[model samples]
Target chain A: MDILGDLLLGVQTAFSFWNLTYCLLGVFLGTAIGVLPGLGPTATVAMLLPVTFGLSPETAIIMLAGIFYGAQYGGSTTAILVNLPGESSSVVTAIDGYQMARQGQAGKALATAAIGSFIAGSIATVLIAFFAPLLSSVALAFGPHEYFALMVLGLAASVVLASGSLLHAVGMILFGLILGLIGTDVQTGAMRFTFGSFELADGISFVVVAMGVFGLGEILSNLENESDRTTVLTKVTGLMPTRADLRAMLAPVGRGTALGSVLGILPGGGAMLSSFASYALEKKVSKNPQQFGKGALAGVAGPEAANNAGAQTSFIPMLTLGIPSNPVMALMIGALIMQGIQPGPSVVQDQPVLFWGLIVSMWIGNLMLLVLNLPLIGIWVKMISIPYGYLFPCIVAFCLIGVFSLANSTFDIWLMGLFGVAGYILRKLDCEPAPLLLGFVLGPMLEEHLRRAMLVSRGDVTSFVTSPISAVLLLVAAALIASVLAPAIRSKREEAFQDED
Target chain B: MQGHRTKDFWAGAIYLVLGLATVILARDLTLGSAARMGPGYFPTVLGGLLAIIGLVSLLRGLLRPGELVERIHMKPMILVIGATLFFAIALDFLGLAVALPAAMFITATASKRFRLAPVPLLGLVAFTIFCVLVFVRGLDVPLPMFGTLFGG
Candidate 1:
């Protein structure tokens, strides 16, 4: 069957009464969580993992996916209103978005983002519906060697895309791969880094590490400078974009959707890099590049669209292959595992309803977001008025509850606190949390693959880079390392990293 | 001005100590063979990375090119960390019945913006009861409801 037919079949499953309701529930909860500063989709998905134990995996996943993408929409709300990004993707949004808000065009900026996101999300869903089957075939063709190479590529690209020193990023990726190796080895069943502690046997929970690293890390960083900065209190005007505003947004939104859909499939830094890349592309392609920072509607629309589109399509690599592109997808993979569903190539054939239903629900959820977010802008803005003190404690409570509920062990709670402190220290030292979280999430997987590859090749060290795919990936990694060492490229790349150019 | 320099120096010294400790502890574990590898393989690598990163940080501090001291947040950090510790210690002893409510209260009050109001306690009580009914009895997850309700 053609991709469209399969997508229509997926829509048939998704449009059912139960699935539609679940979609709505997912989007509502997702937006609510996303609006809260510092709580990204990873934490939200982890918190909700237990609640979905009763539901069918499809229903649970559709709802969870809703939260993931809806966050892309709702996260911008806080970034624009309060000048504090809810997630890293929204950091660039804050640059132009808060500027617009400060100029009393907060409503216009948000409205364009919402509409642009909807358009981009719709188009991206269509692209996913059409492209996923083909991509799944490609993933299916990959051998163990190819899979290992792909992961290395992901790790390297993530390093390239990270915001700081290239050397630091490489170090962080290696750190993550190492941390991932801490549990019982899959092949020999010999414990790697446990040091005889039973708690260390199963390995560190990515949830604990991620929550501590990004969630608590941000809170601690903010508290460090809490007294120095205050949240902006911007008055919103009309929420409607003018016709001229709409005209200016049209091309960028289209281009952003196209770019983001393709970029979103990259494993490590797809959604985030796509957003920054789309913004840069818009600037370079724009007739008037000078209009960028001064509330150009495309500045708001393009990245917003790209962010949502990338967010939707990012599910491809995760669903088709067992590998996750980012921490949120890793969390999603964990959720799928908890539900007894392995998110790999067989998932499509083994669970067609789940596969199609999820694809169909993305469109429904996007539409639902437009419905919920547009009218509720006032309510969300009111939520931005919440004091950081009250808000942060609630977050801490959720983290405690979520972590404890997973294993029903107080040990995990203590581990979470330990991670919280560690995260705070990392933040103080200017280390980016995303790489750490990514490292922690990918650590175990990388180790499993490494040992498995070694065992298969009878301890052959060259096996990892001998394959054509692996060689290409390693070449790319080497080039990235070389460019980092070059002073000229290093300076240009730093400017790109800062997005100041 | 002297206090600022002293602060960076101490911070660098602390990192150096931590890195040295990691290396020393790492030496105790054999990272296994080059071919097969073992459990300690990754941590040893990470420890080395941490040591290198720490050295770079220490060197950066040594140069002292610019002023870098910022006021440390003692209160919220202590409260957040302390409250989490309190919850962990209390959970097994007091059980979820008393421990959960107390933890929730501590978590709620940890925020500097909150005031000691009766309303929050009431909310905590209601929330605990809801969790017990849903997660413990309703879902039948066999949570640690009470330590010795029947017998130890």
Candidate 2:
């Protein structure tokens, strides 16, 4: 009953002129960035963070959240039209999406992706609307010890779940923790790792690191692979899926939503994991599993659905508990703080309209994405004809502009440049940047909680295990880490890490 | 494949050195005791972890058996790195007013397929102004801009 009233209030707020306008703008820009390769929603949101400084908190979040989902949807378009994926999550979509395009079913593949995303996004929003308050209350039970444990678990999971060697992941995480330690000591008024520079007093900007890894690093990588720019000459036809296609897709869509909604709540690349997991699951369950990689519609639909759903629902932990499930969500938490809103149980009570409005606008934004993407497919497909030479320079230009706009600091731009070089080197070395990013974003939060918990416990280390919630979270993290390291679990992990030939 | 292990080993060694440097740097900072858990606590722990991980990476590189895939193009990678370094140095002195548009134009020129056009140059200039006005002037952000005309 309370959920219904809150949802109603949410709808009322979402329907307002200002909220609606930003929602539209967010989806539009989200789709635009999604269509363009290299820029993901995180960088786009980071770029626009300053622009939204003047708006109300609810309005800003609504638009930013919309951009996130919209980018997920838009990302698939490029994956289908070209083999390029805007992010790792869309990599699976590219597998069969581009294949379907090769078979002259680009329209159907795109339509399925859009519709599946809409259904999945809407369902995820509803789940969040109903489930968030309950989740918020549960989070309210957490003391500092629990938060510290949870953060530790988050960092551990991020390292364990990251693609590549666990050793490298752990190294990256430690590096991130070090980077997070650059600013003045909140506890002792001491500055560490500043190297006597004034900029070091505040630590490295999240925008700088984010832009370096996602924006500049991607551009550098893209520039390297300039030869893979050939577009298929296949014609797109059939805007809607056939009846048989729909029947076959329905079950996969449901499975995807179910998989995504759960995985999205976990820290790490939960959405990306779920999307790939859904595709793999669909193939395993299908009677015709052999048809898995050969341009199957279910392949495109299931993962697309899962990706969007996970992207939307990941906000649950971030909003209700101030626990970010991913780097992007962590950025959103930062944005929330910048807006002077403390995210937690009190948020629901203090700013019901903001919370509900953001939730309701998600559904509206999903609808808007569908309507906007369908027509824009033709436009975006045409955009693919723009030469990489012409296109890439523009992307690089925007990246520089965005990085500079973040704090209007030349130092940050230099910081971004440094990271970009570092990221490129890492990429060359086959070390993934995602784990490093996860580490950088979560490092400061984890430190704060760890210190707070220790302080509250009067420097007793046992306090983390004394609390039930913290104990369980820590145990789960331990189990996950143990599973990765144990000889018995090593074989299964090797299989898990296999490229699925 | 055999030689790449040597590369990885060297890389790990360098990271260890960097981590050690950070530790040395952090030692100068005054971190309070257990009750406060100052900034130095985080970095010192991180530095220790990094050094350990670096050693682990070095060991793994030495032990790995499989043939390494050679996907890295050294020339382009160097070029990209060089360009980024150039941007960092150029951004402040050139004042973004002249620097950004020129850098973008140069990047376009570097791509080989796209020649420099007046349109992109003009667009970047316009964007630079918009960014300065909105982010710096309007928002009061301390960006490094030579604003004799805009009253910096």
Candidate 3:
């Protein structure tokens, strides 16, 4: 009964004229940008973050959340039509979807993706409405020790999941933590690494780092070895799937949604990981596993559903625990902080409108994607043909302007450029920046919790393990690290990500 | 050049230098005790861990036949970074009108497909106007169309 009342309140807020308009605008822009090659949801969100500064907090978050999941929908379009995955999360979709396209089943593949995503998103939205409040209630009991242990688990899991050298990932995490230390110390009023600059006192804005690393850094890499993209565009006919095709997709969609919703709640698990895991699971479970890479209907359905579900449910950790499972969630936290809201369990209790509004908007956004994307498939196909020559400049221009508008200062722009160069170099060294971004966002909070926990226990380190919840979290973190270090699991992890390369 | 010129080696070296730098810099900030940590304790510990990780990575790079670093492409990397820096410097003095187009032009040059032609120039000009309308007029970002140097 209470949930029904809350759901009614959410409907009232989300159905408001302006909120609907912003939600539509967000998904439309998200899809348009997502349809482009070489741009992921993280970069898209980062570039567009400055645009949302002018809107109300509820409307702003609604739009950003729309962009986050809408990109998942758009990515599958490019993957199916042109064999070019527009986002990393859609890489597995390109395998079978592109095969289907080449076999004159482009429309069917697109339809399947849309249908699967809609169903998965709807289910995940409901799951979030039920589970997020429950999770927050548990999180409400967390002390500094437990919180610190939770962050450590999050960081360790991120390192384990990062698709590169474990040592480099750890190094990057430490590097991010150091970068986070460049602001004024909250307790002592001591400026640690400001180098006597007033701008450094507030610290490096995550927006600047995000734009520099994900946006500009991505552009530099795209420009490298600039070969012309040759798209063998497929003709799309029969915009609806057959009854048999629908029947085949149902089981995989259900399984993928179930797996993705669970994984997406875990720290460091989101769209990309969920899709990959779904593909692997589908391959193992299917009776005709050989059909996987050769246009099996389940292949397109499974990963597409999983990715969409994961994208939606990944909001849980960020919304409930104030811990970001991925970089996009990190940006969301940054957005919430900018809106003068501290993200935590209290968000559910104190800002019920925002909490429920965002959850309901996600389902509405998913419905919009299903309705809008099917007819707009042709335009998305055309968007992929936009030359890299023109696109990178616009991105660079946006990055320049967006970073500048953050504080109307050139210092942030300069910092972005520096990080862009660093990001490029790190990429060349096979170091993934995702973990670093997560660490940068978590670093200050991690340190604060650690200090407070120690202070509470009179400097005794055993307090971290003595607390039952904290002990379990620490044990899980230790196990995650140990699993990554184990030679057999390390190789298996590489095998899982091999398809990405 | 003589031994393993692997990516891990350079990455480790960079990390090693950065970690040491963090430790050295944090020395001035009082570390205090674990109970009441000063500003320095966290960074110092993190920096030390980073240094140790870097050392292991460096040794691993030398011992193992790992993936080599790819050849650095200087042109795009330099031009893109250079154009960004130019925009930052120019936005204050030359403003968005002058800075954005110039930066766009330079960024376009980084692409191999770019040419000294009219159509792309026209497109850049059109884009600049659109940005002015959206970011400045519509969103009311506090950027001048022309800079203080223009006496606006």
Please tell me which model should have the higher DockQ, number 2 or number 3: 3
- Model 2 lDDT at residue A256: 92
lDDT of 2 by residue, B34-145 (tens): 7667666667777877887787777766786533534555554455445555655776666556655566666665564555678766766777787678656876656567
Q: Number of the top candidate by DockQ? A: 3
Q: List clashing residue pairs in candidate 1.
A: A176-A439, A180-A443, A180-A444, A192-B39
Off by over 4 Å in 3: B1-4
Model 3, C-alpha of A393: deviation from truth (Å): 0.4
TM-score of each: 0.87, 0.91, 0.98
Per-residue CA lDDT of candidate 1, range A1-501, in tens? 566667777889899898899899888877876677756787677667766777888898998899889888888888788777766677778878888988888888888889999999999888777677677777777666666676776777676667765545554565556566666766567775567889888877777776666566556665544331244554566887789888878998999998888878775556677788888988899898997877677777888899899999888878887677777788888778878887777777778888899998999999999988787777777776555655566566667666777677777778888778876765554455566666666666666566667768877878877877777877887786677678998888777667632
Q: After superposition, how far is residue B98 of candidate 2 from its true place, in Å?
A: 3.0
CA lDDT, candidate 1, residue A290 = 95
lDDT of 2 by residue, A1-501 (tens): 477888889999999999999999999888877877756777677667766778899999999888888888888888888878755678889988999888888888889899999999999998998888888878788887887787788777876776666777777777776776677777676766676889778878777787777666776777765654555753466877789878877888999998998888887756788888889888888888887778988898999999999998899888888877787787788778879998777677678999999999999999999988786567766665556566655556556766666656567767877787777767666666776766776777778888888888888888878888999999999998888898877776566556522
Q: Return the candidate ranking by DockQ, descending.
A: 3, 2, 1
DockQ for the candidates, in order: 0.37, 0.48, 0.87
Error of 2 at A115 (Å): 1.0
- Using DockQ as the yardstick, the better of models 1 and 3 is 3
Find the candidate with the highest TM-score and give its number.
Answer: 3
lDDT (tens digit, per residue) of candidate 3 on A1-501: 289888988898899999999999889877877778777778778888888888888899999999889999998988888788878889999999999988888889999999999999999999999999999999999999999999999899888887878899899999998998789999899998899999999999999999999998888888875656655663467888789989999999999999889888776778888999999999999999999899999999999999999998999999999999989999999999998899988898888889988888888999899987887677777777888798889988988888888998899988999999999989988888988899899999999999999999999999998999999999999999999888999889999888889
